[model samples]
Target chain A: MGTARANWAFLLGYRFYVAAFFVFLAAPLIAAGSFAFNDSLFPALPWQGFTLDWFFNDTEPKLGMFHDRRLLRGLYYSFVIACGVSALSVFVGTCNAFLFVRTDLPAKNFFYIVMIVPLVIPGVILGISILAMASQFANGLEEAHGIELGFLRPGLPLVVLGQFSFIATITSLVITARLRKFDATMEEAAYNLGASRLRVLTTITLPFLRPAMIAAGIVAFLVSFENFNTTLFLVGSESPLTITMFDRMAKVGSTPVLNAVSFFLMIGSGALALVSVLVQRDRTKV
Target chain B: MSQRDIKRLTLFLLFAPFALWILLLIVLPHIGMGYLALREKIGPRQYEFGFGNFVEFAMEPIYWNTLLRTGSMSLLVTALALIVGFPIAYYIAKIANYRTRGAMFLLCLIPLWVSDLIRAFGWILLLRETGVISSSLQAIGLIDAPVELLYNDVTVVIGLVYTVMLFMIVPLVSTLDGMDNSMIEAGYNLGGSGLTVLRRIIIPYAMPGIVSGCIIVFMLTAGSYLTPILLGGKNSSWFTEMIYEQFITRYNWEAGATFGFLLLAFTSLVVWLGLKLSRQTLAGTVARS
Candidate 1:
């Protein structure tokens, strides 16, 4: 609208600032990923010829992330946890959406605020609180009846619960937003046409909510995969990839192999995010 | 079955999951944590409920000081993210070509998709003494010695601002996107300068988005553990670090719970203050997203 009277100097400065902002966003990630290919032992710039050793080497000084048993196991643990978390979060989240959006539930506003509490609190506190409750429950059980509950200890189950507590809130937000936009009259019309409630839900409403469910699932998966603060407190002997990587980084500083892991994570998360965006776009168009 | 029976069934199905989630995850845990925090260790295996843990926190200067520092640093990070993110949000929302807006928005989301740990690792690669930036400066003869740029407050702020940038931008863009172009044109036609129009019309209209963005950025920054530790290094002195120490290192659950609650309480207070100052409700703040 102001093109005819736009300030040239301001425009130039604005362009420069935007360009710099993009660089600021991208530079660290690119720099980190570049070192993955560096042949140097230190992940630094000496222009030592690029090699696949960081990703391929098997032994000792230059162990590849793929070959590192500990890291691979950690990745496997993270995957299993992510799967469990996403499934639980999406299921519960959908139930939550139905409860909040479609029903004339009592104290709905109070419940809604309670649901959001998990999202606002620190993940560290979330992890700690879950840990405390589980341990206290476990301890009381042991004290009163000499009973032991393995899941109540710092373990994968607790990790899943901690992650799910907040991740479910995200999924609920997603599913609820889409559900709020849904035309409930369609279900009423189906009922008028002699369709059962279950039939209407499964055949019509579920199909409509599929995209939001899928998008929320993908988001839940990604969040669970990369989670650290919560996982750190609740993890048992078997560490997640984030914990493993952080330990390695803290103990031994930067290695090209860690950089290699970063590169793959960037690609993996980027692809999933792209899929989520496309799914949401598809929903919008529909 | 009667209609009453069907209604009962539906209610049971819906209320069960929601009740289980809130009670088991949210309500019980916080209650348990509160119990833990209130305990005073009287003997090896004996405990009694008291406010000793909270009292200790108030009595210790180092503890309270670290808490204050973490709060202030988070505030600074929130401010910085808003300042850095506003124009970019404006660009994407109003200035970018309609066809390219989606693509531009995607570009912003790309960095955030990568985990916070990886993002911090990237900063390490760039800011470390032997990292790219210092090395490049050396290669260009800008300096003779490698500068250790990592493990500092500035680096931590930079990492945090970068981490939370997308959050601020998204809400701002959404709010700004709803702004009518005719209003800006009206402002211009009325002889209002560009800066005046922005301050009066654009910002006021985007105030909800701005407040929400600030709230999210502040919450994320305050609760953040990895960025402050990884970027600020051993001297980070972040309050979360103290809580971590109490829980993981010292095995002092009582003290840890106390610190955790203090962090939660203070951050909530700040968030409440922020909402009040901006005249936005918590629901409204969250709704903007």
Candidate 2:
């Protein structure tokens, strides 16, 4: 009876500790969510009255977030750049994963390490390096050929390219992890049964890799969208949402509009993550 | 040519995109950065080949001080993470029921689902003088006044630890999960106390996870710009801040590249040493396991 009581006490203690940890992890997110609906402009002390004014009401200072053209433009730019980065990364990462796992590539270890180099190197460094190279290339082109590539001059393309340097590494690692677990015997058997490599790959390997591809693509999009260090160097005059938000915070004090934006993003990302988790669970069950 | 040669050629062709991308986008640019770092910043628009930039970085007391600060900060964060993460990892791996373990693991990973920006923002909210933590502490009379918590080195350390803790935890969890629980039981059965069993069996078993975790957390904390930028404020600056100023504000690409290369070189050297140390520790753990 004493031992049973002791076990119960231990279990209760463990449960409390676990709960505390969860609360610690979740508190910031919850606070941000609450502050989004807060009536006050500043994140001042004492709980202000609740209002959806930041989200819906359009006025001079708090320009109804829905109608805020600058914020919308920033969001649009962020989405477009993220999409470009994700697509490029997925393409290159998938190909790299295929080469690493399924193909007979010479000096595989060297390539693998080379592929992961960008990940270890700081983002700020990568950003500056890419910018320097691009500027030099642009200068030489203009001097020699009298040709202009306005898009390449520290804008969306540069942002996508800079982001791709790291995003591709992430995608490659994820797809590679998935690929390592894949049973290659099926592909071998298919080839042995007189199937062409292309057919075997397309019908078998591609389908098998599709889930990882999607996950990698989504993660790449998120990384690019939220990316600051590299994007700061390559954004030029245009701004992504994160950059816009950061600039606003730096210039002025905190605003409820920023909170509203963050809250909406949190909800949106949470929903997407939930869906992905469900899909992953279903896949595992299958 | 044989069929094998054709297959190898096909594979090489398949890998062409990655090779080209890495060679041009990463390797070439890094080499260029290294070269730029050695050059002199002649003007806002010009650079001449010299070692003046390196000399400038070396001569600056602030540079060395920031480097030391960043290194020590990373080390402290790694140690804090190990303390917080190990018990949780141990509990999940060895003690918890299967369902509970899964749930606990997911709980740990939830923080990672949020972007680092949002996470840092969360800390900003919590650690601000008029923020939740201070308010609660004040309300509870823990202090006479709301303390200056944000924009300090302590806050920076907390933010770094919170941000990089999961990096330590996940690797540790994976390593510890692979460990056999019966070893601990055997140690205990041989008249060893719980502390002895833990020290003799569990610590050695989890050493790889701990080492790898420390390396990853240290590297991440050292290289991290966002957490330090947001939380550390202007007064408490890291080396990366200097790099940012050179690149963004001054437009001194040569100096910026030089600083970046120096930071990279230092971090790479540390990581290389960490890898060697961890390999030895991991081997010892494996032998014991």
Candidate 3:
């Protein structure tokens, strides 16, 4: 696979590029996490004698983020939204997968292309568009029924919906990747045995799709949990963890405790990602 | 019900809910945004449709310059992601064995799970005036004082390149993993040079993935608001930031809607051009990924 004399220069250059890429990928995460243990107020270098003060100190100078009620509450809101979005996106995205991969519809590609429009559209456009649409719809409902539907305005439900608009699209694509590889002969065999459509859908298609749904569920939850640009304008009185963290970092001049939060978050997502990988690998093995 | 009717009903039921959802949320909202983009508000509760919004964008150099800057910057981000990501994908797919390939593939993916906001903050920790880079240099007596490394285009480019590289790599890995390695070996057996084999065999095979990755990365980078805002600071001239300002800060929905459509248009045009040049179908590229 190489010249008689190995191109040591190229090999070294290639290895260097890969090593540099890995550092580029992992440095910020490692840096952010390392500074969390620093006892200094700022997260810069010259690690001021290591301490767990950021995680537990409740004193005036640097308060432990773990004991912070506001952050925890924001975390709570994010959890709720993530869970709600997971449920919604799973149901909707699974149905979307079935629609694209299973059904016999004219202009199927058109539907798929339209569905994919969201993936490329930025969160800003979706946020403003959803805001404008919801406000308009709420106005119409108010004018027509003399009812103020505050739910249409902004909240967790709206956040979930806004996130779902694209999350579900992504989910469907994930499941469709599986669906395309699926052997339809199983479904045909079930039908040949006089199994009803409902029974076949439940017994054959649903069973086969279970793993994909699980994978998509994890992604849906992660996407919903970390979402910011779309969730920012859509969440009302209840801001999610990302928004709170953004406010603290960009606006309030946050402490190194924010670094501590980033540390915990990196560890947490790493664990969840590990779980997702296991689930995916498990499906392949099965 | 008749068997055919029941079958048709089942199909319809299976598709209708998602169809209606997309119609309501994804499609109509854009239509609303488009309608808003075309109109101008003359007075309170009074509106008129015109090309004034587009004209305003053209009349203002700052608006157009920001648009052009965002275009070039996003293109740079896309190109850098492709350049940085291709080798990693090749390493994961071709060099790594079955046991390690999956693990290496997930390495590129792990960053995505971390939120973009935090990722940007991480860079700020390292690149800000009193940040790690400055402090380390100062420690080594490279410079006497903390240097201003933040609030610049370089920071924004680094942040965006990091943000979108995963999008590029994932598709590349998937596409390359599916490729038969024997083909590359055959090219070698025929005495083709390494660069010749890559240009003729691998690049052609990976075009769909390459194009799809570019489309996704470019769109995400261009539409991105948080990373540029955080890393590039107050003067960061991302077009999405402009759209956000028009809609949120200035309360000008019409102008904001126009910018939103313009952003969408620019991204779609880039994607379309990429697809055309690569001779790839959208469905084929997305399906491959």
lDDT of each: 0.90, 0.79, 0.86
Candidate 2: stretches off by over 4 Å: A1-16, A192-194, A282-286, B1-6, B42-47, B138-146, B280-289
Candidate 3 local lDDT, residue A191:
92
Model 1 chain B: worst 10 consecutive residues (lDDT sum):
B280-289
Pairs in steric clash, model 2: A58-A64
Tens-digit lDDT track of model 3 for A1-286: 4653478777777778887888889999888888889988888777689989888887767888888878888989999999998888888887777777767877988888877878778888889899888887898889999999887898878888899888988888878877777788998999999998789979888877777888888998999888988887688989899999998998988789899888888888888878877776666764
Identify the candidate with maximal TM-score: 1
- RMSD (Cα, Å) for all candidates, in order, is 1.7, 3.3, 2.0
What's the residue-level lDDT of A175 in candidate 1?
95
How far residue B229's Cα lies from its native spot in candidate 3, in Å, is 0.7
**Model 3: per-residue Cα lDDT over B144-221, one tens digit each:** 998989899988998999988899999999899889989999998999999999999999999889988998898898
Complex DockQ, candidate 3: 0.74
Give the distance in Å from residue A198's predicted Cα in candidate 3 to where it truly belongs.
4.1
Q: lDDT rank, highest first?
A: 1, 3, 2
Off by over 4 Å in 1: A1-6
Per-model TM-score versus the true fold: 0.97, 0.91, 0.96
Give the better candidate number (1 or 2) by DockQ: 1
Checking candidate 3 for backbone clashes, the offending pairs are none
Task: Tell me which of candidates 1 and 3 scores higher on lDDT.
Answer: 1
